[model samples]
Target: MTLRSEFGREGNVWLMPGGSLLSAALAAALVVVGWDVVQLASEEALARAAKEIGPTGRLVLIADTQGRLPDPRAALAGRPRPFVVAVGAGGAFSTLADVVERRVAAAVLDADRPFADLVAALDSLLRSTPVAHDANRLVARLRQREDEARRFFGLTPREQHVLGALIAGRSAAEIAVANQVSMPTVRSHIRAVLTKLGVSSQLAAVALAHRSCREPTLLERMREVHQL
Candidate 1:
């Protein structure tokens, strides 16, 4: 039988029985399969957690290598209105110091942590009174600002549509094409929007528009039509 040596500690090689070689190969294969199973299970757990959390929130895994989180104002702009939770090691948390300072919805330390711990943390965050209060206050303020903006700008229906496109970061040319209008007409509408909003630049106009264009709640709509 051919003898094979297994490398161990420095300058140490142990000779194994020829039968043991086959066993070793089987063990290696088992280890690889076990690792793959663990990875798949982790992914599935995270997926289930995300699904349970629903679209109203998100969990962001932060790492030391991650440079910076996007501005929440810009990042949280659209529908589903998800709250953000940051999870990572202490060093990772330090990297997101600014985000923490801004009081993100939640933060959980992840170094050597269990997956269950993360889900529990998320659940706790969702149940926290302070988090709910802050969210409600934010929504109320956004609605108030939207009301003020609509009243102050006094934009016509066409101008409102143009403004929406502009806020979506559409270029004048793209807006023209999308609206099936000439470049000159688009530019004219853009200028009119800027003038009405009292902003000189497109960026400023877009910024102001974003500050004001939240989807109106039913109560807000009722108030708008004076039915409330």
Candidate 2:
């Protein structure tokens, strides 16, 4: 991603893709609300920025959707910055539910709404509390749960990848294509994951993976933004 805009300020508000009119409008709205905006244009730029931001100052990222940008949660890893995800009304619950469970995004907003609504949400989030503190605690717990699950399952790297694909709703054929492997090889990996996870079906395996983390903490400052 390329940096499309910048302002001399301690805090930063990042827009994943700033070229679109909607993103531009949101960036302007954030600036109006006293947030110095850094608009990222592409996935590369987003990835670069995610790694470059240090663990100081206030940082908030606004992503149109999880799919449009790189995994900020993974990229930020130990940094634990706050994220605002804009998802469609129909898919908001499912998407935000996953975000909450993964501790990826601190807030969710309706993409169908006007930019003003998002600005209002951000304003509330910025004023409530320090989101990074809660986010860091939540993420640390998530990591522990994930590590425990990995150890208990004893899944190899390939098997873990297969399980992740299953959780993502990828068909065996799609997984094979993505991994550049034969259908039979992909099936073998799937079988290995199922065996290690002690599940009879892919759905069961996915459910078990989701069950690994119980009671993931939602960022306190964003409780009023989007209810899942």
Candidate 3:
């Protein structure tokens, strides 16, 4: 028999025997577990948001860091709300525009001069860009796809509810209000969903919820039932 086929993730390779039922079952189980992890990651993102918004009172840190970060959580840290994107390498890292939708707590400009002056200037241009609203139109369109989630996704009811709220563009605070859970708990659930989906970034998770946006956010289609 040929050796098990190989699949790799995060630098580790998994070899599973193709013809064995046991191997297939294990593989499927692993996939589900992996998705579960993605969901956890999403909730963690919300926690990161809360921390950023919270006080130690808050400070906008400056340095050559936090861009192209592999983990979204690490990407955001200590750099206060209104980001000051200064000149950097070749590209302008417009981190400041991140939460423009919400009023920025504050902005701090870099006083030190840099070689990449042009790049820093680009950040100024980006900061001026208007904030966009969190539109629920996509959630409305994604309702039909819920069944596929139920049938193929095997997500727990709690997972579905948390995901549904996210698709509707509700913040973790909003979800906490609706679900009666503390904001931190809601954030945890969000992280779980991201981990399960194997995605980073809230927008990506929302896009997945749109799932070929021909459907609706699960709750919209579920009707008469409410979920956190």
Candidate 4:
């Protein structure tokens, strides 16, 4: 399921990878138990989204061990990471020995287990104490800021993408290559982005965009990854 699907459900946020039967089943189970499930396209997207959630927000990171999971330490670094749960065939859980040793993951189950057993494990993990704010509220606030920034600055989607590339420290040539556009075109987009954001230079634009989004920092990351 995409992020836009069934938003604002009254429960924890279940971040899952897209296109997996396990993910689909787990998402359904979590939804039945009042979790707002968000299926992202990749591990990077999942990690980035997870960072936006607050301490109080119950976040369950569900990953299949097809080898796309990020280093739990790096992905969960510098923030209060969610409870990670990995399930897959074979010795999938063994690969995450370090993660489990560090107590970063709540549980790692075998995919061969019955769906009911997996759900039961999730239920047990869900009993952990919750903190302060809701993940939905955080997500909504982030969306509001992004909408406000776009509205106030009159930034088009393409302009937002250009701005994101600039924020990532990508040069005009790099942006052109990434976006498959001409150097002149990339420069033109940069100029438009800077003008719309009311910034004098690329550096200023990046700083302004960061300030405009403020907390979460996920917005900036998302812009760079998903092009907003």
Candidate 5:
């Protein structure tokens, strides 16, 4: 299966090589769950890696980092499941180890993760995500998703803009200036977003908006990877 297909389910998402997502999934599945592993990396790389790990799933396309990651609040909106969602700064998860604290059902960040740093962070995170039998992390994550979905649905474009700004940790005045709108307009947008998102406070608004965006494109990832 492709990265999207393999990891579409709920699970702890980590910060690592985009290709590693596929590798980890397959390794966890076939090796641990008695099934074949799928890969989403380049054909040559997959072929070479297959020799090391063995093949199980077919590749539909080379990895394509499409869409920006959902705002942190939005990450809570994704369907309930445990999976890692890594994103680089330009659009990748720098260090989602904490987010995936075993209890983290999924990570929702950028798509421009650095190979070396990502691997190191994920290794460390694997140690953190609660693995205890009594942990209810997945349940909490599911609740978060429902909450985010209810908040963002039918939000107007301006409301979305306002929420996006809040997700950036911007102040209402800053949002107004950045959006080139009036202060009242920004506040109105904020109120509207709050009402729609079912949140009573602005801080909550910012947190939710952070998880709603998706990953950036491959081109965008490359630019960010190079600090371009």
Candidate 6:
């Protein structure tokens, strides 16, 4: 029989050239348990990766030093069980430390390093954690949160922009300058964001926004993959 028939369509479960069949199974098991690597170069790529992996998987995201990274909480909002490892330049890590701390499982900031260093970090992380249990419970909780966030904080484009800036810890004056608006206009947008998200202060608004936006779940990802 040919390799295609032996392994089924897409060949995801098949052994690679010069690799053992057992190693393939082990890799598949890691994916199922939500331990995988995602390399990102832009916000769009990060979003795509997040959608593919879902929430329960452990992700080691290697970001290229080019574009802005997505807000980790928003990028991971749809996931039911979220664990992330962010790898990037030192400046990137420092700039995003708060979000990283809140959202990612770990962060490795070594901009000048080679790709081998990233692989080593991922290996160490996988060996540290046991397999996750109680996926169903986590999924249910995630679904509830998703519903609530969508209902309460479904923001407009402008609001989303404002929210993004707020989460990045920009001041009202800075937001005004960046968006080419008056400080009063920025404050108004901030108030609107707070009202829509049902929060009291700018910090609370940022926190709510972080917790609300996320990519698709694993089941959703599977459906997309199968359809493709």
Which candidate number maximizes lDDT? 4
**Candidate 4 overall lDDT versus native:** 0.58
TM-score of 2: 0.44
Q: How many clashing pairs does model 6 include?
A: 7
Model 5: per-residue lDDT, tens digit, 1-228?
A: 322324344322222233644345333532232223344334344334433331211112112334222222233233333333333243222223234443332433232344444444444443344333332453455345545544455678677666655655579889878768899888888888788777799987655544532323323323343462
| Candidate 3 segments exceeding 4 Å error | 1-152, 212-228
Task: Give the per-residue lDDT of model 4 (tens digit) for 116-176.
Answer: 8777777666665634334344445434444535532476677777776676778889999
lDDT of 6 by residue, 117-165 (tens): 4345544655555344354453355445546456333666687777766
| Candidate 1 local lDDT, 90-208, one digit each (tens) | 22323344455555534433322333444455345534432443444543453455454564347666776776676556799999899899999988888887888777998987666
Query: Model 2 Cα RMSD, Å?
Result: 14.2
Candidate 5 structure lDDT:
0.43
RMSD of 6: 16.8
Superior by TM-score: candidate 3 or candidate 5: 5
Query: Candidate 6 at residue 38, lDDT?
Result: 31
The deviation in Å at residue 214 for candidate 6 is 3.0
Give the per-residue lDDT digits (tens) of candidate 2, residues 1-228.
Answer: 223334434256666566666667777766666667777766567657765555442344344544342246555656536545533231233444456556556655444333467678766665555454464455455455455345324776677667666666789999999989999999999888777766789888766655451211211112222332
Two-way lDDT contest, 1 vs 3, winner: 1
Q: What lDDT, from 0 to 1, does candidate 6 have? A: 0.48
**Cα-based lDDT at residue 130, candidate 5:** 32
Tell how far residue 66 is off in model 6, in angstroms: 29
Runs with alpha carbons beyond 4 Å of true place in candidate 1: 1-148, 151-153, 214-228
- For model 3, residues 1-228, the per-residue Cα lDDT tens digits are 112323333111121112233223333433332211111123244344444334322212222333321122343455533222221111112332232212331332322223244224333433344344332332232233333333316455687787777776778898899989897888788787777766687788777644422123353532223232
Q: Kindly indicate the candidate among 3 and 6 with the higher TM-score.
A: 6
Q: Best by TM-score, which number? A: 4
Per-model RMSD to reference: 20.5, 14.2, 22.1, 17.6, 12.8, 16.8
